[model samples]
Target: MAEKKSSALFVCLGNICRSPIAEAVFTHYVKEQNLSEKWIIDSAATADYHTGKSPDRRAIKCMKRHDIPMSHKARPIIAEDFKNFDYIFGMDENNIRDLKRLAPKNSTAKIELLGDYDPEGPCIIRDPYYDDGDEGFEEVYQQCKRCCQAFLNKVS
Candidate 1:
């Protein structure tokens, strides 16, 4: 018998900050558990503001500080993603709203806030793109780490 594969997509406003952090955190957790083969993880944006761009430099730095490797190009959420992913997780209310608006009528993905899985934190992943310092990026990384761990525990 073979293990079943599950897929998740993380989303945010621009795909260069919060969403990519969540995606990377979750991927790291999965790899650590040796379950990477059983999961398909990715991230996207509700807007195309940074389409094809790398995640924010601050976000990359934060991930590096945590020793988690990340590599992703920004991309807008597409209708097909709604059907392909088993779960579609948004960083905040606005991301959820946009996902809901873009999801196809027949989409099978379970759309919800990524923070909903965080047992010890708020149910909203804040964006750090406009923050004055790296603190915001660090905060985002911490939140994503907790949320991703909890989410993995639930699904695995």
Candidate 2:
């Protein structure tokens, strides 16, 4: 019989920055390993702000610089996401609190801070939206890359 797919949902306050980067990096890594089909990956926001927007342009540029090809429209987390995804990763403490507050009683997803997976990095993927420049985006990208690698290593 075919096995069930492992699904992940990356989340932040805006969905246009940190979460998207994490989604893109994780997606790129899985694809590189030819394991994309075994997983369902996506990103979302904890709130409605920028709900229908594209990821922040700085985030796009950061991905481009790394040649990761990020392309995701911003979206807020839906009630169903709690049930659909196997893992729901928040970018920071606020995101984690929000996710837990919104999750249904029967939610089966393992909700945790994505940075918790980072072996050698900080346990918070700070928002880069209000930062001075694209430099913050790069930092976020690096954090996501490290966390993604560590999470995947633990899971796989």
Candidate 3:
């Protein structure tokens, strides 16, 4: 096998919810497929609002229901991320636009909407904070699983 090549960055506004769940689900799914070594994967926020915080408990609980563990902490996107990650996936358009503002000039990082990978078409995962429920997290988690699976198929 020619060495597989890829690196992915998941992004959201706060990094305390959606993005973290995406990171956990993608990491778990790729590992189970034994393709973890082929790619670099991580997550960050478009805003610093929740920097240094752990994922929201609601999100953690939701992911746990799916048997996915999320031990990763939240961090805001850094200048280096625009250079380091091959792909930067945002939880929604607003996050994507915000991240674009921070991206380096002439950035080659492939910024995208995470849901674009959803077979369901360009739908954004809803934010649960507004409603205080895991329903949103669960929906995003399922989409992340499908997307990551599709990504692996394309890359590996």
Candidate 4:
């Protein structure tokens, strides 16, 4: 029998920072565990702001520093995403609110905050787009790494 495939979508306000990092971190973890074939992971934005753009440069640098690869372009969360993924994790409260608002009535995905899986504590993954330094991106990377690790452990 074929193995069951689980899917997850990470979401943030613009998709150029936090969400992409989360997606990459989760993907990295799955890959490291040799479970990539069993997982479908991606990232999206709650708004159309950065659609079609690559993740912010700072995010790229932060991910690279940790040896995580990120190649997803920014895209807006669509009603179809609600149907495609088994789980949908938002980076902040606003992203969750927007996702809940946009979720189709018949959608089957479970929506929640990614930070809920963080072992450190349940906290929001704030956007780092406006930050003038790399610190915010670094923090985001750390949070994503911790949450992704914990989430993977739970699902494994």
Candidate 5:
């Protein structure tokens, strides 16, 4: 039989910032480990405020600096997503609560905080949209990198 591709959906309050970065970082990390072909990666938001909008400009720039190409449109978490993804990672506790609330009782996705996978640092991927400059964005990138690496190691 053909091998099944594991899928992951990264999420935050809005898709523009943290979630997209996490999605991009995880995608890049998987490719670096030569497991990209075995995985399906994407991102979304818990709210529809930025639906259809592109990832935040700061996030785009951060990915550029890392030489990781990223292109994604904002979208809210949907019921179908609960069934489609094998894993759904939220950036913070609020996201986890919202996702749990939105998910159907029979939903198959394993919902959890992405930061929980971090070996070091805070267990929350703080929102940087309101922060000054790119420092917050950079920190998000670093956290995502660490979390993604650790998460992948445990699952794969």
Candidate 6:
């Protein structure tokens, strides 16, 4: 039998910051663990604020510092994402709630807190959009890395 495709969608208020970073982090983790064949990881925003832009410079720089390449373009999460993604992870409670609201009643079960996978620290991965410097970017990157690892462990 063919292997099933287990997909995940990471979401934030604006795709330019947290969500894209989560996408790259999670995708990198899966590839590192040799689980790439079983998963299709991606990301989106609950809002369209940066719909056509690349990830925020700080986010890109953080990923580059860790040698992770991010190829996803910012986009808004649509209703059909609910059907295409097996799991929907939100960077914060607000994004989760927004995605849940757009989810088809039957697809509501797929939405979850991104931090649900990270039980030890804070549950919400803070947005670095308003940060004054690189410090917040590094913090977000570290948290995203932890969350990705936790997610891989659970799915593996």
Q: Using lDDT as the measure, which candidate wins?
A: 5
Residues 11-42, candidate 6: write the lDDT tens digits. Answer: 99989888898899999988888888899888
Q: Write the per-residue lDDT of candidate 4 for residues 56-155, one digit (tens) a residue.
A: 9999999889888899999999899999999999988898899999999989999999999888975798888888999999999999989999899999
Regions more than 4 Å wrong, model 5: none
Query: Candidate 1's residue-wise lDDT over 1-156, tens digit each?
Result: 987789999999999999999999999999999998999999999999999999999999999999999999999999999999999999999999989999999999999998988888699888888898999999889889888899999988
Over 1-156, each residue of candidate 3 has an lDDT whose tens digit, in order, gives 577568899999889888888889888888898877778889998878888899998888888788888887889898889888889998788987898889989677899887877776546876666766677777777788887777667666
Give the per-residue lDDT of model 5 (tens digit) for 15-75: 9999999999999989999998899999999999999999999999999999988999999
TM-score of each: 0.97, 0.98, 0.91, 0.97, 0.97, 0.95
lDDT per residue, candidate 2, 1-156, as tens digits?
Answer: 999999999999989999999999999999988998899999999998997899998999999999998889989899999999999999999999999999999899999999998888799999999998999999999999999998998898
Judge candidate 4 at residue 74 and give its lDDT: 94
Better of 3 and 5 by TM-score: 5
What lDDT does each candidate get? Answer: 0.93, 0.94, 0.83, 0.92, 0.95, 0.86
**What would the C-alpha RMSD of candidate 5 be, to one decimal place?**
0.8
TM-score-wise, the better of 1 and 2 is 2
**Full ranking by lDDT:** 5, 2, 1, 4, 6, 3
How many residue pairs collide in each prediction? 0, 0, 0, 0, 0, 0
lDDT of candidate 5 at residue 53, scale 0 to 100: 98
Mark the 10 consecutive residues where model 5 has the least summed lDDT.
28-37
CA deviation > 4 Å runs, candidate 2: none
Model 3: weakest 10-residue lDDT segment is 120-129
